[model samples]
Target chain A: MNRLFGNRTAIAFLVLPGVAIMVFALIVPIGFSFYFSLTDWAGFGAFNPVGAANYKEILTADPVFWRSLVNALILMAVTIFIQNPVAFALAALLAHISQKASQIFRSIFFVPAVLSVVVITKLWVNIFNPTYGILNKLLRLAGLKSLAVSWLSNPHTALGSVIWIIIWQGFGWALLFYYTGLMTVPKEIEEAAVVDGASWPQTYTRIILPYMFPVISSVIVIDVISSLKQMEMIYLSTDGGPGQLTQFIAVYLYQKAFVASQYGYGNALSILFVVVAVGITVLVQRLFRSEGEIQ
Target chain B: MNALTKTPLFDRSAGKRFGKFALYAFLVVFAILQVFPLLWVFDYSIQKTGDLFGPELIKLPLVPVWHNYARAWVDGKILRYFINSSIVVVSSVLISTVVSFCLAYATTRMVWKLRTLAAGFIGLGMVIPIHTTLLPNFIWFNVFGLINTHVGLIIPYIAFTLSFNTLLFAGQLKTLPRSMEESAFLDGARYPKILASVIAPMAAPAIVTVLVMTFLTNWNEFIMANTYLSTDDLRTLPFSIIRFQGQYSSDYAVQFACMTLVALPPLVLYFFFSRWIMSGATAGAVKG
Candidate 1:
């Protein structure tokens, strides 16, 4: 048993498969991506090395890349600032309500989160259809004829509409996180706060919110990463359409590589994307770290 | 004992009740908003395009057009995509689960020199977005003759998923008593035997959590499946649904029906295992 269990070879064998897969499928590919970012590869046939021209071009000239990053940042901001607070408030209310009602609403809220992205995006795409959508019809019914427009096509509303779909689908998970976090906040803490003459807002702001900071931070981090990686929804709905108004980095990179056949430029964009994503994530962690300590 | 009722600011009973009512109303409205789109899709799945328009947009189908489902399943090639999805999802889930289990076991249970390094390597995989690797993976897969193959898609799925699932398993394994494994070893149960009999059973809940999460993720995964597979026969459900929508852009009922078909399995799974799904999803938040 000692020989069998204590063997380094045995441990190596146990860990090898997962490590190998990650190295082969994940690590090696990123290395190749970095390598390819330097060349003018069209994804096929012969290609010439362009040094950092691809990167230079993307940094200075590519409006689409900038737009994609801006859209992702807007999404991150909306999710953290808008969705998080709303979900947190809803979760707090749900915590205060009856168990049966909370349970029902919890499941209802989570339905969109659990469903396939294709389904959710397509559902909204149809609903946002200008001519025959329920939204436009309802607006016309309410005699607000000017309110209805092509939700996904119009430049003014396209990003907002896409953001709504993303938030709607993602709202439940945020709610779930906050609800679970709120549930674990012991009753005595609130009771103690009340006994100390803390106001309702004061209790939440000074006590409960601080206590739930870890959960909040983690959720925010997840939101930032997810917002940065927004792909399938944008892909299936707008495909970064109406002149790339709703372009996300993930979708734009794919389009550049596969659709436009500019593999090298796509690689450069992806490499930069990776840097930005990692940089933002680390920054968020640090931001939360100092806040957690301060609180 | 209610927190709101006990608050000093809500001195008026009517105000407290009204506040509670308002909260409930807000929650209920949000709940409806979350679910109503899917219900709308369900409604559209059964209605003719003609009925889908006009004031009847909010109305249900007087007689259910059940044939829409059959048409979507048979004519839309959703069945093929379903099979393709299941094959890829099941294979990848099984592979990732087993590999992660082993990796977790080795890292947690054994005293290995490279354990921390191994774990860190796996953990690092999480931060790197899949899109960053897409171009290179496409080029590499094409070079390796894996283009338009399920194996091509499954390899990356397992790679990307291994980090999270392994972490979940390792967390579970750490909480299990080391004494149990030691006693099992003393009883002449070898590493493999101990793993199968001791660790596996103890980690059943974690295993299930990983399995369900992986299933939903693999089921919903679009970008890789879309990028890697070009052949119609190899395309997964999400890819197929997108293709079907593009091709039959005018057929609203069929498109809705096809979406329903593509979405049904995970919805049903969520309905049954909502707790597991919820916990698995929030696991990162709670643990991190």
Candidate 2:
């Protein structure tokens, strides 16, 4: 078995193809991104190197870059704080319900997650249209015409509206994760808590939560990365409009590169993006690690 | 474990009964919030255009404008884009599944140096954002003249999926006992033969799980497709919606039809394979 399994030729054939693809598709492009980010390439003709100028402009000078960063932070906070806890509570509730009902609710909730992001974004954009949207129509019926503002266009509501759409689409995935995590908890733990006179809510808060630390942390980690990677929804809906209030890093990078035709600057933006993404990933993992130690 | 909720302990009082009622009420309302948009799109897909002023939230049209679907299929070019999406999704899913299966087997089962290093390098692909590669990939595609072609989109789609699928596959493959393969070797069965007939069958469910996942991700992928596939004919299904939303800005019903058409496959796949999809999701999160 050892000789057969360890055949060098066979192992090379099996592994090399997949590894080559990753190196070509992932590593090589990053290498190119770093190399070209130094030069002032305009997607075409001759250009000279302008080392660190793009990075300097982004870090210290660009207001939109900062705005996009702040927006991403806000999104991360909402997803981690609001979306997750609520989903966890719902999963707790679903765990208590009948199996049939739980299955049905799980399927319904996961529909948006399975649907295309474009579908959800465009649907919300339509639903927020001021003239004929169902939202404003319903608001007027309730005699609150002032509240029936253009959700995606108005300054005060634009960021909130875009964030709501992002949260709406993501809610299902969080619910699924929590629900699945809840399923893994032993029944005796809960029953033992109940026998000890702890109420269901108290049991969940004190015992079940600590048990679910790893799953909960993983969910938050996913929420964090996805929040940072947010682009398609904002791009389709607001395009970070209403004076760039809804800008995010990924979409901003794309707009700089492809839309604005600043290839070199875009590469710089992308390199910075990798740095920040890697940085936050490390930070979040360490945060969770230390918290896990406390637990 | 939650049988505790239904027993005499928790279900005894009227207050607890009221609480359960309230819980159902909340769950029902949230479910409505989750599914209402899709139902609204379906309802309005058949309703007449220019009826946006109606007070009702949704209505079944007395005369359904089913031709809106025809218009979306032909004039909206959803048919063309759907075929384009199929080519990209199918090619990528097939390649990713087969390659990851092989990669997983070699890394997990074979005795080789650099196995851990190779596996670790590919695993890093999971955390890296696709945006990091977008600009350079665009330049490379331009250089190779793969831009605006299905092959261009399919190649990268296969790459992005390799790491996740390989991890999931490796996690599953590691669980199986090696005794079967050892016995097969005693019977003079070749390594490839044992792997093909034994390992593949054992990991069949995981293979399906990763296949569905790769298919969904590739199907809904828009950024790479939008950046690379610039021509109308070559664009994928999700990419066409941006164009349709603009061109038929006033033709809301037809656009609704277009949205519904683009969303149908994944929706159908999810419901049809909900069992595999759900378990696979949990397993991937836990293990991969």
Best by DockQ: 1
User: What DockQ does each candidate score versus the true complex, computed on alpha carbons?
Assistant: 0.63, 0.63
Per-residue lDDT tens digits for candidate 1, residues A130-179, read: 88788898898898889899999999999999999999999999999999
The TM-score obtained for chain B by all candidates, in the order given, is 0.91, 0.91
Task: Write candidate 1's Cα lDDT for B1-288 as tens digits.
Answer: 888667656467768788888888898789888888888888988988667775744977888998888888886788788899999999999999999999988888788677788888888677889888888988777888988899999999999999889888888898987788789877878777888898899999999999999999888988888788888888888764676667877888888888888888998999888888887777778876
Q: On a 0 to 100 scale, what is the lDDT of residue B51 in model 2?
A: 62
Task: Report, to 2 decimal places, the DockQ of model 2.
Answer: 0.63
Alpha-carbon TM-score of each model against the true structure: 0.95, 0.95
lDDT score for residue B160 of model 2: 93
The 10 consecutive residues of candidate 1 chain B with the worst lDDT sum are: B4-13
How does each model score on lDDT?
0.87, 0.87
Candidate 2's residue-wise lDDT over A117-223, tens digit each? 88999889988999878889889889999999999999999999999999999998899999999998999999999999999789988999999999988888778
Query: Taking candidate 2, what TM-score does its chain B reach relative to the real chain B?
Result: 0.91
Off by over 4 Å in 1: A1-7, B1-17
- Candidate 1 docking classification: medium
